[model samples]
Target: MLDIDEFTPGTGSYEWHLSGDRLLWSKGLLAVYGLTQAPDRGEGFFTSVHPEDRARIRQEMAEVCAKADRFEHRFRIVRPDGRLRFVLDRGVVVRDATGAAVKLSGVETDVTDVVDASTFPAGQGAAPAARGDGRMEEADVIDALFNDAPVGIGIWDRDLRFVKINPLLAEMNGLAPEVHIGKTPKELLPEVVDIDGVTSLLQEILNSGVAKRDVEISGCTPARPSERRFWKEHFFPIRSAGRVSGLAAIVEDVTEARKAQETIDALLHELNHRSKNLVSLILAISRQTARSRPDDFLPVFQSRLESMSAAQDLLVRRSWQDIELEALVRSQLPHFAELIGARIILRGAPDVVIPASAAQSLALAFHELTTNAVKYGALSNEAGKLTIAWQVSADGTGLQIVWRERGGPAVLPPSRKGFGSTLTGAMLQSTLSGEIEADYSSEGLTWSVKFPLNP
Candidate 1:
């Protein structure tokens, strides 16, 4: 148990200034590499990087300092004593007003302890010969792997009784290590002892003395009895006098990995559905624009399509998750972003996230409102002001949005509906599933939109 905290990674900060053509390292960083600053060797600050990793780290750093890309790299380092260690660097590029990358800075962490030494071939990380006789040192290496390795390790006897189990495997089974010492899978978790259980696998390993690889199992553990977790396991026979004795099991928790693949599958399906729907929507908008304004179809259709694209871009960036309402509005009015809080005022809960479909429809509606404001409404004059506000209902299941314009020329309600007018009126109301009110008062045009917010 004391071994759990025996080894810990170290971390430090770094900064590279492009214009100054220099690098700065924190004392903690030098400590992480077990190096002392030579007072006059700033140019050679990064010279300690292993030769094999130098070129790659330099290239990645160049990308961060030139293209302003995020940096996340793992590389090996050599200490003055010739000992090798692994480190991970995470950084971000800083840009100026002209979008020029000016600085690259972030933290670096030592991860030597986490890199399994046993995986390296002999003469590399593996012990030369343990105690000169190699017994004690070999045992220590195996002990380190058993206790400090990220995976779970367990030993089972021929009768499939738990002989020894590490803390990680104990936690996975939701049982203490001692409790599992004499218990079989059926005795501990009979429900999970079905066909996929390890009972037969261990028996086979004991019978044939050949290891069985890549066996997966799923079960509920006391740690989280309600959630069925999964593990990818392997069994290797422990030999005695060239014959099979007990079996050693290496278990890897792959619940999150499986769930991630499942999520990617669902997202792909949704993207497919969304793509087809968007294409159909674009086709409908094109026909409507061409029919309503034959001479001005191109510009009108393009403008509306851009608004839809803006919404889709937001949705795609967030993996089709709910979008920030303010972000959705600002995206549609990108040309007026600088004037957001002044000429174009926004008022609402900043954290209001809206669904993708609602985001798209609302994007179009806001675009139509903005176009009208620019051409014939408040935004057409110097004294005009546009105020947009939204609120969640008392029940928290609905939303109310109001787009009000002030100080514009006298307005009259349109006698015939144009493409923007029809969409914002009947079409938006249908998708929003609530009332849509447009007040074309002599002062200005105010559009009030209400909708149910689906979680």
Candidate 2:
């Protein structure tokens, strides 16, 4: 019997005396089988063999003993604790002078971790062993690696028929592994696969022996039949005896990544557009302010620019989607909090969403109104009061805002139009495509603004 202590952990040796059906198992083999004590005879080992593989292993052992030939087999064993483990058994038979088998000696190595790490599909046989050359063959390694890889992998013959497909690739196509075998891409995925083009590509790779990398393919797959998906695929020529035989492909899903890149591109374009618009707006404002108030242009221009900056800050916070009218008004009146609930009355539907362009225009218009009110209008006197109200049109297509002042000094129309009046009237109209009506009666000031909801 081979010395049990000489064998490494996870490995064991065994000797079966053929004539007497006697067996000697190393301590390692006992541990490998989850046994507390050695079995009585060589046949006891068969009892631990998985039922599905018992007959085949027994027959192979019998033949090896009778013929005194070398034996190599990979099979699963059932431990006493009901745990199944894969193992490789290899040995040679010893015979007497008459060539009748005397003993069978072999080494059994645990291969459970190797097989599990491979993640071969269920029912796929145990891992293959190295051949006599002591090096694992490329074909065997490729087979194992292909099936166990996380990414989708497949092989197509020169005829464009699926020669083999891994479980991952089969799942991506929403088919079973067996269903993909011997089927062309067009036949299996008529709606998704570009049959002619893919077939031509595979043929080209096989004939030219050239590899194609990072080719993006986009189409609706059965897994997500309604929405189109993107995949990054690389095709390599499978060679046999130094000649190209078929084409192999590895694929990765890139739908989310691609969509994310596209969204970033759109945001960059939008940013550039808004930047151009802002530059043009500043140029116009500079020209208007210079012509209107050349003597005191700096102060007026700085105030207006500050108001625009505030409006832009609000827009940035909301991703420039839309601003609520109430929020816009509150943000623009931060310094007039005391008048908001006391001298000033605000009334409106709370759900109004102001368009981006209209928001900026309204912000500037509100700044002018509030400035005037603080200086000489409703908020200037102890008894002065102001009411602002807004409502959507009955058809829901337009919004109307009204501002009325009371209990203030008698109002009179300005002798000449100034920046405030010009901005509130013409600038607001052009910016928001709205109509404004203002009355400066002796009693007070009244203003009305009407605009399309979309604008």
Candidate 3:
């Protein structure tokens, strides 16, 4: 036999002898079951079970005795005073030398405070299946839904004390159900009650008997004292005998939901801003193209628009976060793919992400450079070559990009500024807050630009 004194103080222990239907209960067991005195060993034990659960307990006990196997059961026991308490009974059958069952010994725990409706037997606290009436008892249905609800639910008396709280509400407050009984919101959530005005709101609901819906509360709770959480709470006045008695509250955690909404709002704002900038840029490009190349205005305008569109496509793909420098270069230079490895060379600080605002201007500058090279510079002949290289500054404050062309024809400085020159020089400087320098040397056309990486 297990030593009753060795078990935890509040838990109950028991032993049952199958031969004579004898039973023994420890002192703790008597206290847990609210028994004033020990009953005749086996006579009164089954009588203490709730009437509805008695038959099932008897059948399960008989099966355990006959099979000589382990048994585990949970049921409600009616205390001497008529209160119903949930308990768990677990034991292993003891066998004799002949392998016949001799006794069963195990422990019992009063789980009334912790048990929820989901653990109740079918048709008791659980939802009823289709049957003769096809309707469940009102009290049972209320009990099932209240305890099994996903959101926090609680009832507070007119005095603002907790009259009843479901497990979900208790857990949200970082307390057990029993601890919440008779406690006010001020006592349970002192840290946040005032900041969120929870107690005042509940009081108002009680006084006015009016319902408050979707009241947002945000603050720290004992459950996570250091972390802030948000809840959307609905408060309704509870009425008894046609008079305001208390208040009932349903609370849903909306912390993540609110965060998601903020993210979407930010993205939408960004989209609107970028769309306006794109329109402004397209207008400027059309005006400049028309002024510079009037006879061929449409082709020039279309080419510039296509280059800007490619850059916008890249930004959209990245959620307008940042555009990779290598990706931008590759996208703007697709026309040179055939000569990329042999005659055209690209080298730069790898994996650099350019800011969105600077990406479009830089893409246009690259288009102008490539167009000039194909028309008059190095790329016009098979023997010509082009080299593009870039690097971040040693202090990491800025980036420098160099474009050099060679072997096509002797280079000469433009006698007058054209659209291509203006874009690569003045336009880039104004848009990117950068500096550009061009050298028309006998060897090649060399151009260099320095700009802040972040700006």
**Highest lDDT against the true fold, candidate:** 3
In model 1, residue pairs whose N, Cα or C atoms come closer than 3 Å (at least 3 residues apart or on different chains), thus clashing, are 129-134, 130-134
In angstroms, how far off is 242's CA in candidate 2?
1.5
What is the C-alpha lDDT profile of model 1 across 114-203, one tens digit per residue? Answer: 344333323322223345553556546776788788999987666666655777988888876645644566777765636344677678
Residue 263 displacement in candidate 1 (angstroms): 3.0
Q: Judged by lDDT relative to the true structure, which candidate is superior, 1 or 3?
A: 3
Cα-based lDDT for every prediction = 0.77, 0.78, 0.79
lDDT of 2: 0.78
Q: Provide the global lDDT of candidate 1 against the true structure.
A: 0.77
C-alpha lDDT of residue 140 in model 1: 62
CA lDDT of 106 in candidate 3? 71
lDDT of 3 by residue, 414-440 (tens): 988878788899989998899999999
Clashes of each: 2, 0, 0
- By TM-score, the best candidate is 3
What shift in Å separates residue 68 of candidate 3 from its native position after superposition? 24
| Candidate 3 total steric clashes | 0
